[model samples]
Target: MRRRRAAGGSGAGRGLRRWAAAAALVALLAGCAPREGVEEIHYRLKWLYNVSTVGDLYALEKGHFARAGLRVNVKPGGPERDALKELELGHAQFGVASADQVLRAAAKGAPLVVLAQIFQVNPLQWIYRPDKSPFREPADLRGRTVGVTFGGNDETILRALLARHGIAESELRLFSVRYDYTPFYEGRVHFWPLYINAQAPIIGERLEKAGEPIAFLDPHRWGVRFVANSVITTREMLRQHPRTVSRFLAALLEAWREALDPANEEAAVQVLLAADRETPEAIVRRQLPVTRRLMVPEPPAAFGRIDEAAWRETEEILRLQGLIERPVDVRSLFAGNLP
Candidate 1:
């Protein structure tokens, strides 16, 4: 599914043009608007319907937002509307975005707090031509055309990989190849950043079935670290509606758990197909396993728990990449704060 750009969040790290095609606002069908007697909450999406970007659907599907007494309106984000501004102006009661985006929003005093780290791993796959050409390793990408979306996790990973190899941005022909799969397939560039939630595996599987194949070189496997996406909210919401936040998180975790189950998988795909109407069912289905992998259990934690060790590594990558000037104390962006 395509992520329709909402608000100002689709900045430097964004790749895809956020596109919401067929999904109607479900709340609208149920007569949900800012009604006089009914309580309402607006959710500003980081983008429309990317699989990893499904906090709204997940939360709502499991009754988390409804349990919080919020008649949630899922607003598709765009390049012009700022998610932070929407939250600030009370246009949105909550937002579904990344920990990096929350950090930027909080730095601007958006009153946001990260309630949970949804994806334990940032699924960035540094993709190269399957022909096994010059872009085989981190050091090999010095002057290649490397593409990643702005505001997405791939930015952090790309910068970190460059830094690890001691390569300057000046040394490479870096281009913003928004999150479309055509660039690599047509041989327009040598390498591009990918997420398992987005492009790499879906196309890989499709091509393999068609008697052609491509492969992904995971940057984390080469000493790069970044997590894909997470659940973030405002600080006041955390403090004032503490139980509400907790309930929402619990419900969202439940949805995440169900999304991982093999039996319940088809229903989850149905929700996705309905939302990102432009994307094919095959592509959306292909992205599910990688998305499920994000919900896998960590050693000292249960399923759907965020791993601190992974986040610390991500922070280091962001700092080295100059995305975060210096690492703010990491204590602020983890579990245990919702209520």
Candidate 2:
């Protein structure tokens, strides 16, 4: 048999063929670009894209929104920062946040509605120093200082967990800790709430790099569950932009699909590391897999499907704990063009 020739040939023909291939691929994709229902949207995430907001960041970067003619602006979140205010103040039209904010906003007359549950299972966790002031569990938190911020449903979660475990708020002291995990390392608090996707890995990798080992404790295993961050929009925006919502969700789901790919793990880590450049790659790698696992641990395979049961369960938890009154519309929770 004759030996196979190299595909692009040599010299000038090789250069010409490579250019032609690149041009053709661009033309093919541009030719397939969406022609209908384009919308300009700003997406302010409740937190940066590390763990909490990676789903949105990945969706935005992968052209999920582009095929649907939607442009999204994803802004990161922080302490004393309100994403809903960003939308209400007309800085952004869409964003991700916890339902607690939605309830608080609705109670104050913002007419915001949750659209999608990004993390179906709560990713909230507790981080402690086993070598220092090591915490065995929530019970160990009694009479000890813990660092936390007053955002989302954090207090409600802790209280609910306390009641179940027969722990008392009076037995523990709350210290304000910045969202970062430094306080735990410095012996400022006995425990701190963290998102396993973002903080856990960052802390783990940083400490490991510094020769400081980190210990993680799942609060949910101890009966602490908080509503995960969710996609939300003002009712006014939704009513005037139903098509936009559908398009946005479509693109977001596509991003989740890419994240679901096992081979894309490293690529996904790079995207996440883009969120916090100060964070090490090892941390990002560790966090991304945990976040991905939450999307759909098992799979009949709906990548970004909103779970009404999960939403209501969270609502019930909030209500029984008096975090919300009556009920918020679960149907209005996540709007889509799906049947």
Q: Estimate each model's TM-score.
A: 0.75, 0.74
* TM-score, candidate number 2: 0.74
Off-target runs (Cα >4 Å) in candidate 2 are 1-38, 49-51, 78-81, 130-140, 150-152, 179-183, 186-188, 206-214, 316-339
Q: Per-residue lDDT of 258-277 in model 2, one digit per residue for the tens? A: 86577787767777777668
User: Model 2 clash pairs?
Assistant: 43-73, 64-251, 114-333, 115-334, 143-171
Candidate 2 local distance difference test against the native: 0.65
Please write out the lDDT profile of model 1 over residues 1-339, one tens digit for every residue: 122322444442231111111011222222343432125656677666668755457667657667656666767776666665565544554566656665544333334566666667667676665654455666777667777776556666677777778888788776677656677667677676766677676667766776754666677678765655566655545554555556656766776777677787788888777778887898888888877776576566765566666666766665555555334545565546433
Q: How much is 287 displaced in model 2, in angstroms?
A: 1.9
Residue 39 local lDDT, model 1: 59
